[model samples]
Target: MIRVEEAIAIVEANSTKMPVKQISVSKALGYVLAEKVISPINMPPFRQSAMDGYAFKHSIRHQYDIVGVSQAGDHSNIKLKTTEAIRIFTGAFVPDNADTVVMQEHVMANKESILIAAMPEKNTNVRPKGEQIAKGEVVFEANTLITPAAIGFLASLGIMTIAVYKKPKSAILVTGNELVKPGQKLKKGKIFESNSVMLQAGLQTFGLEKTKVYRVKDNLKATKKALESILNKFDIVLISGGISVGDYDFVKEALLQNDVKELFYKINQKPGKPMFFGSKNETLVFALPGNPASSLTNFYIYVAPAIKNKMGFAEIHKPKLVRKLNADIQNTTGKTLFLKAKYDETNVTVLDGQSSAMLNTFAVANSLLIVPQEIEEYKKDELVTLLPID
Candidate 1:
């Protein structure tokens, strides 16, 4: 068995960056930028009012006379001279001659002229052109994820399209002859297939949507044929079962027979020691344990980050937080254990069960408490690393 870090390093070395493509801003969310996005025009495009007030010069301290009324999207044709003010609403362009703005509430207005109660400050209430974004400036850098706020920022720069990396295609294959389809009546010793559904939903969190699920009986011929058939279609293939040393486990043998390059066969981790990884024709193949929690945990820790990096994201790992353990934890040596835990601002508590097959306790889990291989027991109030669920 190999260490977890060694296995991760092997996977990262074989990972390839995806090519870039131009996509419309409407459909660019969650994709990583391939090129630097620069602003073509100044944000606001011209000097505008930041608030609903009156536009005038600072020299006109006490006197105020209405010259014109300017609303949003209106061009100011009338210029303000000494002691002259224009009624301006929010987002209206400020005239060239105007240098200050006095709020309407501070000024007492009559039929034609107004009374200034206070002196207006220079450049007050004015959103100057290029104040938010300057023309020809790099608004976003390459490999940055396009979020909702990022889209708005690009729109403000008049960018309708952007270059982003294409989403990678992934597939899930479940192996077991005793497994029956959902909605079907359960027979004696027959279990419903739930791994594929759980994995599909979990994979979606990492922006993977176009995933296909295939079921194969417990046999070498069937597993080999299924693996070879789906190998050419997807960039990554996830196998849920048939990787252990049982009599029916044939996924590893089938992959070897197909000339797939083996990265690592097993890792020194609990409930997932049989996890395997390989590649063929630049397509990745992951042999995960049959247990639901084990498969999901492995996917989040290793596969998800690999997919994100392949899609050109600059940061592939999720955010980690350091928290004090509320209880003492024990773990087997020589393998890093990622146990489900409940964490909040005050403290973090480990879940009741650490079994790979269990999924009930993981539902309410907000973080994963990591225990390194070198440590045996963590006393109460021990600071530990926690990986937040994204």
Candidate 2:
């Protein structure tokens, strides 16, 4: 057994970045860049027009002769004299001789001549070449997250692919003969298996999409066999059930037999005190309590951070906040308590149904109120720590 902080530290020390792989930028959303990305060409490769307007060399005169027209994508070599202008559209290349552009709305056009209703400043409405980004400039440094806007920026720089830290391959193992898959008729003393589905969704929320699920009977032989196969094939393995010191709890023994070194077997925390963390070679394993709420709580507090670390994220934990308590609460269990609750920017309210088996409150709760072991009670409006659930 270990304290919650010590268990969290152990997990963090063991988690490492995965190998890098080159993937298309278009498909690299939510991935951390393993290499610095450089721009191959200047954004707005040429001096572009910023508006549908007339391009002209700046002069003191209010009127000018319209020499020619230039639309976007036109490779025009037309030159302009001082006091001469050309009809131009948005994004159109401004002739080298032209230094300014006046929006169409600001100019009065009559036949081949235009009068600037308002004399514009020099370089107005003209996007200078390389204004956004210069060629050979570092677009993003290593460990940068590829957001949707990042994809567009990279695409604009003509970057087709980027090197990113590879996402971990993970699997979920559900243990217990008393569990039955959903849609099946419930036999005597059998319950529908939901931990696997809930865990799968939880993993997806952390960006681990390609997860495999396995079912095992609550026996040493079956549990060991499942562990052997999964530990060798996955970077992460999540087992729900069979971890406590029960007659049929074979997961802990099976893991040890399979040479999985236990980092910590339990944590001094509420709802998930029986949680287990171990590693077999390079594969990380988490044995969560079978109770639905406990499994999910452990997944968020521990597994999600491991996933983020493997993918090279700097900030792994969910956002932590401190707010005044909206209601009084007590915890006399002599253990740190994690209570699902509702929170706004300034305050938090611990909801009912803090039982390890119930997830109804968790479904509606947006945060977890952390009650320290030393604090037996907290008065309403007292400051407290909260972790907003994602």
Each model's lDDT comes to 0.86, 0.91
Q: Pick out the ten consecutive residues of candidate 2 with the lowest summed lDDT.
A: 75-84
TM-score for each model: 0.96, 0.96
lDDT of 1 by residue, 32-115 (tens): 999898899998799998878788878736777887999988885686778788889988989888877788788888867877
Candidate 1 residue 273 Cα shift, in angstroms, is 1.3
* Worst ten in a row by lDDT for model 1: 56-65
lDDT tens digits, residues 1-390, model 2? 677888888999899899999999999998999989889999889999999989998889999999898999996958888868999999988899898999999988987899999988999999999999999999999888889999999998889999999989999999988999999999999999999999999888767888999999999998999888899999999999999999999999999999999899989999899988999877999999999999988988899899999888868987789999988898889898999989887888889999999989999998888988788999999999987885
Which is the leading candidate under lDDT? Answer: 2
Model 2, residue 197: C-alpha shift (Å): 1.3
Instruction: After superposing candidate 1 on the true structure, give the runs of residues whose Cα lies further than 4 Å from its correct spot.
Output: 118-120
Instruction: Give the distance in Å from residue 170's predicted Cα in candidate 2 to where it truly belongs.
Output: 0.6
* Models, CA RMSD each: 1.6, 1.5
Query: Model 2 residue 247 lDDT?
Result: 95
Instruction: Check candidate 1 and list the clashing pairs.
Output: none
